[model samples]
Target: MRSVRRTLRTLQGDLARDIALVLLADGIVGVSFGAITVSAGLPVWLPMLLSVLAFAGASQFLFVGIIAAGGNPVAAVLAGLLVNARHVPFGFAVGDVLGRGWRRWAGIHLMIDETVAFALAQREAERRRAAYWACGVGLFVCWNLGVVLGAVAGTVVSDTAALGLDAAFPAVLLALVLPSLRDKTTGAAALVGVAVALVATPVLPAGLPVLLALLALPIAFVLRGRLDEPAHVREEASCPSR
Candidate 1:
């Protein structure tokens, strides 16, 4: 109980405000998801189950959409897996914030884009740890809670789209990462990722393009390293060693 209290105490000020805003947005989207899924004639348990099991908004929505469209269940699962492939890098990036043992495992389960963004946004290790867990646990609760409420009210709100809740997730995500883009390396990486995603979107399946955009990170990093290398070192490397 004290540990939980300590965690909550640390999650104050701007970080707390940011987390609250993000949670509100995600909760609304979660509600939208539940309402839409139920309205599409899926069982009330489906969205709640996916929230706990998958915990990924985009992939879950994709799965529900595909399944609702008469897509094969196997295909829907595969699509969800493909869409979630982006989490591999997220895991790598967020490994530092997650401590050890059960906490690490729980943190991994909560390793969504928003939690990751908040974790990475913080400078100190303690702050990052607090932000990640606070956002993750809060998100898990709010998402599931919202789903429950939406499921109960699903019949009343047959058209979740009319609420414009879908825009909240992406808008909040963009806001979270936009500040980081001011850095040259970060900006270059983002540009490369956007270009890659845009180019691949036409040719690849819905989720594969985003996964392919991860290629941009390495490309940008390599380019940045080359550019930042000393001219003398480059010339020396280009010449034969004695």
Candidate 2:
């Protein structure tokens, strides 16, 4: 009991900051999603469920777009899964901080990009937990609020096309992916995914290109090992001299 209280106390500030930031960021993005959802002719509740349950902005956007584009539900779900597969690695990276048992499960479920980034930024385990929960809950509330607001207002808003709501998803995705291009390998992988998607666009359905992008993962893994070997060898050689 004492330990729990201590942990909670340590988390207070980080929790406040993280929740605030996440709410702000997610609220903006949620507006985009809500706008698109309304324009796509989906039921208002659909966006609400998506925002509340899915809680993954990119995946929710992709799912709605795929469905609106006349794609199958299976295809839409698969595309969303492929797009979010990166979260699996992010979860692994933060596993240590997540602790074990129920807390671990909570941490994993809440391990979105913002939560992961904030938690990883913290040097202490306790701080990481606080940050994660703060962002996670903050994003959840703000995201759902935006979805509801957009859905309700969307019905009355005219000329969704004129508003260019359809472009929001791609623009947001590009923004999310662009910053992660830190190295040649990752850059090449992203380039290849885009190229593959473009080439497959005509041949495949709206959601299929996403799957093709996922297929590039194995190739990246192979390349990653080869890319790291030279650096590892150089470090080993230098260590012997010391």
Candidate 3:
């Protein structure tokens, strides 16, 4: 009984730690988007709403940027949707571990980059849940707070571009992607996506490059099985010949 109680306490502590860390990271990320929203001439309330409802940081930033740059609303929506379509696969991969019923739905909605990363790092089901919820809720609160601050401060700043806030979007994306490249396929896919986006940027409309980039995701997913097999075989070969 004592051992069980001790284990429970340890788990609770770990959950708390994970939640706190996620909140901090998310808050910082939000500040970048909030600044961009302000610079893009959006109202404070608009960014706050995006932070709360849109929830996906990269998509929100891209949507606001496109709209500010004179892109059509339909284009902005399509671009944002295409950029975020990766969540579909992420949801499927983590579905079983997220459990069932309403909690599963909640998990799906909260399945952002940070939440997925923290969840994947955990070995146990209970730990995964705790970490995921921690990251999600933490990101939600901190991101909103950052948005509020940025919106307010953005008005007073003379030159947002001069401040280099434009770099924030790519920086945040790099943070998410750099950690996930465990194999050649993932690395190659990321490179291809980047190249496609860059090449399409000049030829396509402001928002269409995002859609073009998304065209690569399906290819990556289809090839994932074949890509993993080589790694698996390599690992097996490296094991002791017992």
How are the candidates ranked when ordered by TM-score, highest leading?
1, 3, 2
The C-alpha lDDT values of all candidates are 0.85, 0.72, 0.71
Clashes of 1: 0
Q: Better model by lDDT, 1 or 2?
A: 1
Question: Model 3, 1-242: lDDT tens per residue?
Answer: 55335435545765666557557655655776777777777777888888788898878978998888998999889988877876876787677766678767766778887777667766677676666666676677788887788787774443445656546435544554565665566677767877898999887755457546666777678788777788789889989875
Best TM-score goes to which candidate?
A: 1
Give the best candidate by lDDT. Answer: 1
RMSD of 3: 5.5
Off by over 4 Å in 1: 155-164, 226-242
- The weakest ten consecutive residues by lDDT in model 3 span 2-11
Instruction: State TM-scores per candidate.
Output: 0.87, 0.62, 0.65
Error of 2 at 234 (Å): 16
The Cα error of candidate 2 at residue 224, in Å, is 14
Clashing pairs in 1: none
Error (Å) of candidate 2 at residue 125 is 1.7
Better of 1 and 3 by TM-score: 1
